[model samples]
Every structure is written in structure tokens, then in C-alpha cells.
Target: MKDLNKQFSLILLYALLFQGLYAVEIEFNADKTLLDSKKEILELEGNVSLKYQALIFEADKIFFDKKNDMFSGNELKFSSLDNFFYGAANIVEFSKTKLTLKEVEFSTCPCEEKIWWIESDEVSFNNEEKIVSSINSKIVVQGNTLAYLRKANFPISSERKSGILLPEIAINERSGLDIKVPVYINLRENLDLTIEPRIMTQRGYGLTNELRYLGKNHNGFFNSSFLQDDKESFQVLETDNLRWSFNFLHQQRLNKSTFFETNTSSTSDPFYLTDLGGFMSGLSRTLYLPQQASLSYFKKDFSMRLDLNSFKLTNPLAVNQFQRLPGLKLNYFFNKNNFKLVLNSDIAYFNKGGSFRNNEKESLSRVLFNPKASYLYNQKNYFLESSISLLYQFKNHQGNKNTELSPLFELNNSLKFFKLSKTTKIILEPYINVAFSDQKKIINKLKIDSGLRFNPFKHKQQFGSLFLSNQKDIMIGTKLTHTDKANNHFKFEIAKLSTLGQKILFIEEKRIDLPEPFSLKLKYKTNNGIIFKSHLSLDSKNNFNLTSNSISLNFNKYKILIGHYFARNIEIYNLNNNSLEQKKINSFEFSASVHLAKNWSGGFKFINDLEQKKNVNSVLSIDYENKGMVVGLAYMKSLELDWVSILENDTFKDYHKDRFRLFFELKGLGSIGKPKESYLKRRNL
Candidate 1:
């Protein structure tokens, strides 16, 4: 009997090896095996294991019918080679192209804890299609059944497929109970579309559609929304019943050195954003929306660009701004050794949609040219640079043409001193700049496309003092800096300006004779992930009155910012009267954010009108995150202007409004509400 069994084992091994050479190979091992050649059947018992292609099966017992080329097992456990899927089943049957199982439990999670899984009565997989289908399945999470489905299909690979995305639910004061269901369609590998339908308990139904496309050298998206008979439109603002909004953005690489880009957006009414805006509604508090397009070409030494820019006014209190119908710009650069030269030229037509002089629309055409040249001298401890610039502008309004030219000269010098040791190094730098411009006064009434930047910390005092102005002036500034290898930094800067030809400086519609206005700035950074910055501006002629002051601090887990702005006498535009009026402004701002714990965070922000003793805006938020889930809550209060009362009283009146939001999200699945990160990022914290 022993001799016969040994001969049969050799025969079985040779037969399996021959079959593997030309067709699907099946390999199995067991403690015991039996074969009946007369019936063409094979049986295995005690720890049976089989492997073919990328699939592996383990069972207590297994049987194979050689004539039919099939395999079956009981109390089986199976998995894929990549470990992307694994499961256990009561009964399992598999062939070269398909697999079927009964009373199966499976999951894609790799962790041993098994946070979630799926239970199904039957499950089958098609090798050729790379798809898995299940009947009568239940989704279980944390040992609790969450959902049930009669039939479902899931792809085993990461491929784009059309399906219904998760819906968003929210409750707020403006819209009450709001819900949005979005449907996605994967039209092609490079294109897709999403259509979302929204319902509000207090408002009417709305639809929003978005289309996106991508190519080898181009990409773009279009989004539009429409709502009929918005109840808020008639109840709050008393505007049209129909509301809509649309946005379009596109970018394309025309060639290796050329590019084209365009972005434009519009709304049917001003209140559209306030009522229908998503989580970012708090940041879109502006009264104007911009629309722009540009085509640019670049080379090693030269560049050219064409641009069109416009804006749409969203509020009656805002004044119309000049638009560039079409603008052309050209620039040339030359650099050799320590010498550099640059030439810039621009031409544009500006038009505003409002009647000015003689009941005619305000319009102007401008041509500007600027050229500059510089030379640098460098040494081991000192550096110096000298530059000269010429600016010329030509303007034509109602056929009345005029031109002006100005020349400027400047000198910049800096000295550096350093000390080095085994483990530490320190350096100090002191720099000074002296500039003088020709005594020329250009009398141009319209500021076509230039305006003052309100923030003082963004630019040097001399550069931020005035913009697009042709006046005789002399500016002198100095800055000192200290740095060390220990990641410590400190800086201080001061600047002074002297008007040569004009006795009183005219900024916008304001006239001032403050000759000794200067700014002081300081910044410090430490090695322990902390930074401090402050800026102060004062006018000597006005008893050193503080024009603006700001301070900010940042650490590992917290941030704080505070600011105060005071303008003694400034001229502001009056849209109702079409003129300028002198006014005073005094305001204060505060913002803070902190990480309360490992998985908890909170933030607060507020702005105050000191002159009026009122709060302009305030916001508070709290969030928690853990185990691939997020929950957040927030509240906001804003002061809104009453336009109807303004017209009757000739003054503005403020009314307050409150809003609340709740957010929740489950990672890898979908979200139930808008994420707080959207608005948090807008605050720049």
C-alpha cells in the first residue's frame, strides 16, 4: 500500500506541472488527499490551501472535479495579493475568471480593530470587469448597523465613475432649514459635470450647475445658479423676484512662451450673495466685483501683455470706477555685469458709466512711458547703487490733450558687519536711500487706475506715501537690521519726506501741509516659534498725532492681532452728491485663534467703531476632530446699513443681524454640512 501511494503522488505532481505550462495553474497542499480516477474527482482534508493568479484560498476541506475544471471549499478565507480586500465566507466557489461566496463579511480597512465593514448574504466578483456586486448588504460601523441595501455595485479599482454624491444639510437664520443634493456625471476622462438642487424651508427652490474640462494645455470651469421667486428678495430688499449668479474661469498655454487667462463673475442683485452664499459668505463683504482677462507673452529679455478690466457695482452707496476697455503694455530689459536698464510703455482707454461734465459720460485715454537705468558697486563690507528714471504721460479727454514729463534720481547704500564663533554668528546691516524728483506739477483731475494702499506694513513708507502722482519731492529713509544664527531677527525703519515746490500736499481730495510726517516700524522673531511686529505713523505738524498703529504676535498654538486707525481730517467720496467731503475716522480691530487641546480649537474676531461706539462685526467658532470625523459650530454678527432710511435722513443707520451654523464631516465618505475651514482660511489665521 505504501509503494502504491508513493507512485500516485509522483504522477499527480507531474500532471499538475504539465497543466501549469499552458493554462491556469492550480496548486494545493493538505495533510491528506484522496483521488478516484474512475469518477475524475479529487478531495483534500485537514488544512487545505490553494493559490492561482493573484487569489489565495484557505479552507478546512476542499474538492475538485478535474473533468469540469472547478473548485469548491467550505469555511473558507480568501484575500487578494495586494491586500486591497479580504473576507470570510461559509461557502466559496472560484474559477479562473470569477469568484462567488455565500454569507460573507468583508472590508477594505487595513487596521486589525475593524472600525467598519460590510455584511452580505451573497457576494460575487468578475475578474475581467474588476467589479464586485453584493445582494442584501448591511453597512456596519462600530458594531452597529448604519444602513441596508438590497443590491449594490463597487469598483475594485480607482477609476472615474458616475454616481450621486453626498448631500449637504444646514440650519441658519437667513435660510432656515437648507439642503442640497448634488449629482455628478463623469462624461469622459477629461470632463465632468455636477448639478445640485437646493431647497430651503423659508426660501424657494434653486438649481446650480458646474461644468469642468481639462486638456493637454488648457483647463477651465463654468458655474451658474438660478432661483425663481426668492422670498427674501421681495421681503428684505424689495427687488426683483428672480435671482441668479454665474462665474467663469479659464486658463490656457497658447505656446511655449505665451499664455491666456480670463475670469468673470456677476450676480442678478446685491443681496444674492448675502442670502445664497456658502461658507465663505462672511468674507465677500465688498460692494464691487471684478472682471478681468489677459494675454501675455514672455521671452528672455522682453515681454508683452494685453489686458481688459471692469467691475460691477453691487450697492447703491458705492461709486462707479473707471474701466480699462483694452490696455496694451510692452517692457524691455537689458542686464550686463553690474549695469541694468529697463523700458516700460502702456496705453489704455478708460471709461466710466456715469454722467460728469456737460451730461456726458466720463472717459479718458492715456499713454504712459517710463525708462530706468541703474549701476551697482559692491565690496566685502559695503554696497552702493545709483539709478535714474524718467516718466512721461499723455492724456486726451473730449479731444483736449496734454502731456507731462518728470525725471528722478536716487542713491542707495548699505553696510554689513558680522561676527562668527564656533556655534553662533551675528550680523548687523544699516541702509539709506536718498531720492529727488524734478519740480513739476501735473494737474490731472481724474485718477484713472491708481489709488492709495491703506495698509502701512505692506510696503516701505516712502513707496507707500503717494501713488501715480507727479510732484516735486525729496525723500530720505534709513533702515537697520540684526540677525543671528540662533533664529533671532530684529529690524527698525524710519523715513522723512520734504515737498520742494508745493506748500500743501494734496492726496486725493484732501490738502495737508504736514511736512514732517514719518513712520516707525519694528519686527522681532525668536527661536521658539514666536514673532512680533508693530507699525506706527505720526505727523509732527499735528502734535505727533497717531495716524495708524498696528501690532501682531504669533506663537505655536495661539495668534493675536490688534489695530487702531485714526484720520484727523480726510476727504471721502460722496456717491449721492457726486463730490468729496471731509470726514474723521476712528476704528479698532481685534482677532485671536488658539488650539484648546489636542483635538479642539477655537477662534474669535471683532471690529469696533470707536467714534460711533458700535461694533462693526464679530465672529466666534469652535471645532473638534478625531478618528476621521469633524464637528464644528460658529456664530456671527454684522452691522448692516439701512439704505431706505439713509435717503430720508441724509445719514446712514446701522442694523445688526445674527447667524449660526453647524458643520459635520466623515472622512472617505461625505459631509453633512459646510466645512469651517472655508471661512477660517479667509480670515488668514
Candidate 2:
């Protein structure tokens, strides 16, 4: 009997090897075997294992039919050679193109741990399509059933597939309960779309759609949202029942040396962002939504660009800003030896939508031409550069034309000294710049983008001094810097400006007092990740007229930041009263983030209006993350200045908004809530 069994097994092995020659190469092992050569059927009992290509199969008993080129097994277990997928089934049928299983369990997790898995009545994998489909599937996590589906399909490859994504849930005071379910559509290999329907218990239903496309030289996206009617719109005094917003962004390479880009955003109403929250909502004092487009061309020594820019104000009561309908800029550079020549030219038309103060809508056209030549001499220890430039500007406002021409001369010198050692190195640099421009009458001139630079010390170049204001001036600035191999850096800079031929400075069409002439800047960085920075402008009395300082410390596990800003007795022309007014500003800001424990973190941020003795904005958050999950909670409080009202006592009172956010995510699945960090990141915190 033993000899007969061995002979049958040998015959079966020969038959299997013969079959593999015509199809995929197959290897098999079994304790018992039977062969029916007339039927072309091979049966194996006891421990049986088979492998073909990257696929592996194991079972207690199995049968292979050479005529049908198929395999059938009971109590089957199968996996890929890379172990990317593994599953077990009660009954299995395997072929070259497809694998079918009945009463199956499958997962991407490790077989030994099985952190999560799926059980289905039937499942099939299409090798050609690289997809897995199942019927009556149950998702199991930690041995507990989490969800059930009648039918489901997922891609086994990295390609994107059209499907319903995970939904998002959020609760806040203004919106009550908010839920969004997004559907993703893969229309083509280079095109996709996402449609998200949203509902709020307190607000009305809304829909958001995003379409994106990619090409060989271009990529772009269009995102838009619409709400039928907002229940809370009345709070902002908005009568429109429909609220909508749209944003379009695109970039394209026209050729090897040319590119074009556009980014535009608009909303049905100014309060749309405040009520529903949009891009850059929390990060910046976003008073305007930008609409801009540009085309640029570059070459070895020349460049040209054309731009169209506009802005939509977020507050109706705020002053209207200037818009550059069409602007053209051109630059030409020539370098030979240590001598260089450059030309910069710009032309633009500016228009304002609304009148300022009580005047009519303003429109202007400007043309500016600047040409410069410079010579640079460099050595290992010293460097010197001298430049001469001319600026000519022509402007036509309401048919009132004016032109100005000025000559500028500048000299820059720097000396460097260094000491090197095996373990440490030190370096010091002293730099000075002297710039002189022939002053001209800038009074009664329309100010178009030129103004007094509050922090001139930050601008070290002679070009910056020439462009600081319309009126010509003499600027002298010096800076000293020190650095060491220990990662320590220190810098000190001071600059003073003397008006050459002008008495008054005009900014934004308003006459203003000259800012402090002496500006000072300081910065220090330490090896332990501490940084300190300060900028101050001192009056003739040597008192700080404008001060801004910040300190921060950063480490692997924690961070801290603090800042203060103060402007003393700033003077500006009040259009309503037609008189100069004095204003003072004082503010403080603080932020910190720390790791509380393993897998836990916490953060806090606050901005205080010291002048008003009130908190402007504050946020606190706590988060926890594990191997496959993340959960977080955050609280926020912010004062809204646009929502102010006049009390019966004739005093203005502002409004404060409070909100709480929750976030939860499950790895390999979907998320449950909006992430708190996303909101903070939008504010650039």
C-alpha cells in the first residue's frame, strides 16, 4: 500500500509540473496524494502547500484539475510572497485571472496580531484589475464588529478609485452640529472631482465642489461652495438668504522660459468668511480677498512680467484699497568683470471702486523708469560697492499730470575677520551704507505705493532707501554681526535719514509727520534654540517712538514664544475731521506648545490688546495620538471688531465669539472630525 501511494504521488507531481509548463510555474508539497490520469485530476490530503508566481496557498486538503486549469481547496489559507495581503477561507477556487473565496476573512494587518480585519460571506480578487470585491462584509476591530456592508470594492494598487470618502462631523456654538460627506470621482488619470454636501443643525444646507486637473505643463483647481439659506445671517445684518464663495487657482508653463499663474477668491457677501470660515480666516487679519493674475518671461539677462491685481474688502465700512488693473514690469541686467548695469521699468493703471472721505472715485496711471550702474571690488577680508541710479516717474490722475526726476548715489563697504580652530571658529563682520538722493517736492503728489518705511534698518540695500518714500533723503546705516561655531549669532544695526529738500511726507494721499529718523535693530540667537529680536525707532529725544520685540525658544519636545508691539503717539490725518489725530498702539502675544506625556500634547495661544485691556484672541488645545488613531480637542475665543454696536450711552461695544472643536482619525479608514491644527495653521500660528 505504501509503495502504491508513493507511486501515485510521483505521478501527480509529474502531472502538476507538466501543467505548470503551459500556465504559471507551480510548486506543491503534500503528505498524501491521488492522481487520476484519465480525468486529469490530482487530489492531496494532510498538510498541502502550493506556490505559483507571488501567490501561495495552504490547506489541509486540495484538488487540482489540469483540464480546467483551476485549483479547489477546503480550509484554505493564502498570501502573497511579500505578505502584502493574507486571508483564510472555508472554500476557495484559484485561477490565473481570478481568485474566489467563500466565508472569508482578510486584512492588511499582521497575521499574528490581527489588529483589524474584515469578514465576508464571499470575496473575489481580480489579478488583472488588481481589485478586491466582497459581499456581506463586516469590519472588525480589536475582535469587535465596527461596521457592516452589503457590498464593497477597493483597489489593491496605488491608483485612485471613485468612492465615498469618510464623513466629517463638527460641533460649534455658531453652527451647532455640522456634518459633511464627500464623494470623490476619478474621471480620468489627470482629472478628479470631489463633491461634499454639508448640513448644520442651526444653519442651512450647503454644498461644496472641487475640480482639479493636471496636464504636462499645467495644473489647477476650482473650489466653490453654496448655502441655500443661513439661519444666523441676520446676526451680521445680512439680508441675502443665499451665501456662496469661490476660489480658483491655476499655474501653467507656457514654454521653457515663460509661465502664467492666477489666484482669485470671491464671496457673495463680506461676512461670509466670518460666519462660515474660509481660507486664511484665523491666521491673518484678512481684510481683503485677492484676485490676481500674472504672466512672466525670463531669459539669461532680461525678464518681463504683466500682472492684473484687485482686492475685495471684507468689511464694507473700511476704506477702499487701490487696484492695479494692468501692470507691466521689465528688467535688463548686464554684468562684465566687476561692473554691472541694470534697468527696471514699470507701468500700471490704478483705480478705486469707491470714493475716499467725500471725494469722487479716483483713477490714475503711473510710469516709472530706474537705471543703475554699480562697481564691486571684493577681497578675502574686505568688500566695497559703489552705485549710481536715476529714478523718473510720470503720473496722470484725473487728467492732472505730474512728473519727477531724481538722482541717487550710494556707497557700501564691509570688512570681515575670522578665526579658525580645530573645535571652534569665530567670525565678525562690520558693514556700512551711505545713500544720497536729490530731494524733490513730493507735496500735493498722489501717493501710489510709496511711503515711509517704519523699519528702515531691516532694509540694508541702497535700492531700499531710494524706494522708501517719494521724497528724496540721505540715509546712513551701519551694522555689525558676529557668529561662532557654537551656533551663536548676534547682530546690531542702526540707520538715520535726513530729508534733503522736502518738509512733509505724504502717505496714501494724506499728509503725515515724519517718522522717527533714527532706527535701531537687534537680534541674537543662542545654541540652545533661543532667539531674541527687537526693532526700535527713536525720536530726537532718544526715546523709543516705535518698538517691536519678540523672544522664542524651541526644543524637540516643546516651544515657547512671546512678543510685544508699541507705537507711541502716531500722527495721521483724519479725513472725516480734516485734522491730524494722534493714536497709540500696545499689544502682546504669547504662544506655547508642549508634549504632556507619551502620545499626548497640549498647546496654548493668546493675543491681548494692552491698550484696551482686553483679550483679542485665545486658543487652547489638547491632543492624543496612538499607533493608528488620533484624537484632539480645542477651545477658542476671539473678539470681533466688525460686529460692534453703539450702546444707548453712545459707547461702542464689541462682540466675542467662543467655539470648541473635536478631531478624531482612524488610520487606514477615515476621520470623524475636523483637525484643530488645520484651523491654527490657516491663521499661520
Question: Which lDDT tens digits does candidate 1 get at residues 271-296?
Answer: 65555553322123334555779999
Scanning candidate 2 in windows of ten residues, the lowest lDDT window is 642-651
lDDT of each: 0.66, 0.71
**Which number leads on TM-score?**
2
**Residue lDDT tens for model 2, 1-685:** 1112432333345555565544545677787777677786778777888775456789998877777766777668888666666778776666657777788887755336666778999898887666679999998876889899899886544467778887877666777777888898999999999998989888878888899999999999988888876685454676778778888889999999999999887777766665667521211234456688999999999999999887666654545445788899999999999999999999999887422222337888999899999999999889999999988888898998977777778788877777777655555566666667665444455545421222322443333223333444556676676677776888888887665554355544565556536878899999999999998887763233878898998998988888887777666564445567776667787888888899899888777888789887777899887665668998878784421111101222112377777777655455776665653422321
Candidate 1: which pairs clash?
none
TM-score of each: 0.78, 0.81
TM-score of predicted model 1?
0.78
Error of 2 at 335 (Å): 1.2
Judged by lDDT, which candidate is best?
A: 2
